[model samples]
Target: MGQSTTPVLDRVGFAMLSIIMISVLVTASSVFGTSSNPKGVSIPLQERGSPLAKDGVIIPEALARLAYWDAAKQHAKINNSGPPNNSSSLFRRHSAPLESKLDDILWVGEIEIGKPRQRFRVDFDTGSSDTWVFSSTCVAPICSSKNKYIASESSTSTLQVGEFKKDYFDGTEVSGPIYADTITVAGLSAEGQWFSPIDQVNNMEDYGRDGLMGLSFMSISQLKAPTFIGTLLSQKKISKHIFSMRLSSGSGSELFIGGINPSKYRGELTYVPLESQTMWIVKGSASANGRNGFNGNMVIDSGTWV
Candidate 1:
């Protein structure tokens, strides 16, 4: 299907279901308090277990409902939206298997870089365009706690000129120099991939992951470098220049790098033409509870926490 200029409810609105809830978890530490400890562990999506089970036994119905209700309250409070009317049923339908003990989980995946493959857990964000990682050059306390990418250890790594700096709306920042190296994710590999090796960070005490892997376009990249996903498409590593995601509260989520899994969702998938190549901005109208609230452009940013 071709991308649509007008936003469809199923396409834009429903696509944000999981992200909205997850963003609350992401912003809690950064926006409301100090501390960068992420609540859940980062693991490959394929390895996750059921969210409703404990020791092979289904959790009590009452307990499960209570947990869902609590999560809904948190989601509504953080987003400043109305309380969920029927959160129990909503959770029952969407809740899947999860491997974490947290009430909600932020999806992260593993990727390999360099010749020997230094592994890193990254948040695959669609809001921005820049694949950056913590570097050995960093002496900051935050960088010291997470995995740092070392260029000298990689035979294929090459230094690049100039620095890369990204500032978030909430005051978080990462700055470092650029480098080219081989990066592999979800079985697809891109050679000579340009990325930033972070040297310093500010107001980033709550970020729990090693770095971010941008899934958006190159236009908005801090370095304006070709994106890893774009390289995969250009090299024909993936059949189409597209990907899909499935996120759930306290459940296992999936990210399709180059395609969609029809079984992951119900009904026909809707496509929207990207308003900008920078982020996944699309033309869409928004409403509150079926009542027209606003109409304009929408950025489907998985990385944005507010």
Candidate 2:
């Protein structure tokens, strides 16, 4: 035989996970890449006084935003803000006075969807009952206008955006739905989490995103049949009796999918039965707020007030 070549078979599935570190995630950690800089901030000046330079000067607004973005990124890297293989690497808490380790908040890495859009991370919410993105259909001037629905890629596991109706326009609550679209984050796929399903006619850009993937451990996001926690349970990823939220502000909050580190908290976590209407509201006294200030019924979230 002159030459024999065997075709090799590859078996690993390709999961394209887009991790978007929210500006809020900038609360802690310091890892990053230069590619992350905004094009406005990175634009090189041919000469100091070029017309694009605005009187031989850098744009103050751009500079300030860049500075803030940079700081947030750096904070995350320093704190090792990311998922853990085990439970040990999840958080480095800070309990002060009586216990500053009390203020440890958990952070989830979010993915920025679509180009030239307002970027936001998806939180696993259990407190709220709606899922939305900074989409075009959102008429509130405060909402991000650059958001868009992403559907060009093949989704082995992905979100499906649905019909939209306008919510507001010109400071008036008009009739437009938030709509639907697919969104994925952290290599975890929760399909149909997005909103807004209309094709572009007026302005596809008008509907910023299909919508955001709100995957709060609490019951905040609105789903018809399967709540986020309910889905997690169906997948056998967690227990029906217990699921935890370690909402991060910037430094320490994190989301625990299955269980909390026994050593991380002092007393056991007291979880209230989540009502479909309000979501999982973990209750703690004011002292818990002073210490952890996280995971409370009626007023808890992944990102902290800090």
Candidate 3:
């Protein structure tokens, strides 16, 4: 959300400082109610990246970042939704590690679906409100190396009447049929969760993860169904409607579901009220390394490095 005309700081440095400062600014906000003590689920994050080039050359950070921003912007245009209601109640905690790729540009974590539990790694994106993954019907070259969800294999899988398609800024798309099944993340299960089972991938190359788990509000969801987190809240799977992510250069990153880990962060938590509910939009000013900065509405997006 904060940018500098001069190259005041690199991406990683700026990201770290922003995260910490934001945490301090929005820690005790009413969004995370003060009614009850919230338990934290700490998931460790892993580091990963796209496949090497034909000549075994890694992609440059600037180019990779550009691609990410394009995708994030495309997602932003999807829709607008209101903020979710949050209640601070006790709930069980589940923890897992996330995978970080390309100099902490991409953060992915494991999730399981179906009765028998087909596992896959997904990028938990907050910029979008749709959760989608490759399906067994997908025969695209891009999906050949990723895990595909097989509806027939899961007795709990129900075919929903609808099609799902997402267009990116680059004109590439990933789409498929919708399904409602049991989705498990970090040991917490949300039954009858509706998500797109991607069977068609057009010009959309792999991004080191099987699919994406959108953590934003459901109003932007393409399926018109509750987002995974929303489903969990409605189903009473997690009493607290709170989750947080800690990103870094590589490794040591984590996704805290259900609540925030007090151990991971110290000092009094500051709560910055949201300016808008559609996304994590907050009005705040940012500075780089004690230099001059700008003030405006900032979208706290984890889907891309802005």
Error of 3 at 217 (Å): 0.6
Q: Can you write out model 3's per-residue Cα lDDT over 1-306, one digit (the tens) per residue?
A: 111122211111111223532221122111221122248566665644332221335447544545444434534443342211221111111111135343334567889999999999988777677889898888988788989899999999999898998764434578999999999998888898889989888756556778888876555667888777677766777665667666655445677777666555545555555554456655667789998587766656555433
- Please identify model 3 stretches exceeding 4 Å from their true place: 1-37, 49-100, 288-293
Lowest lDDT sum, 10 consecutive residues, model 1, at 28-37
Against the true structure, candidate 3 has what lDDT? 0.61
- What tens digits encode model 2's per-residue C-alpha lDDT throughout 43-122? 00010011111333544653443344323322332232422233321222111110112222223234433322224434
**Per-model RMSD to reference:** 12.3, 18.7, 11.8
- Candidate 2: C-alpha lDDT: 0.29
User: Candidate 1 residues 1-306, lDDT tens each?
Assistant: 112122221132223312332332332110000111122112344212223345545567634653554455344423435456653333322121122332333346778899888988777776667899899989988787888899999999999888899764433678998998999986688888889989988766333578888876565677777777677756657544556666544344566665455445555433445544545555667567889975766556545322
Candidates 1 and 2 compared by lDDT, better number:
1
lDDT of 1 at 80: 37
Backbone steric clashes in candidate 2, count: 87
The best candidate in terms of lDDT? 3
Off by over 4 Å in 1: 1-106
What TM-score does model 2 achieve against the real structure? 0.39
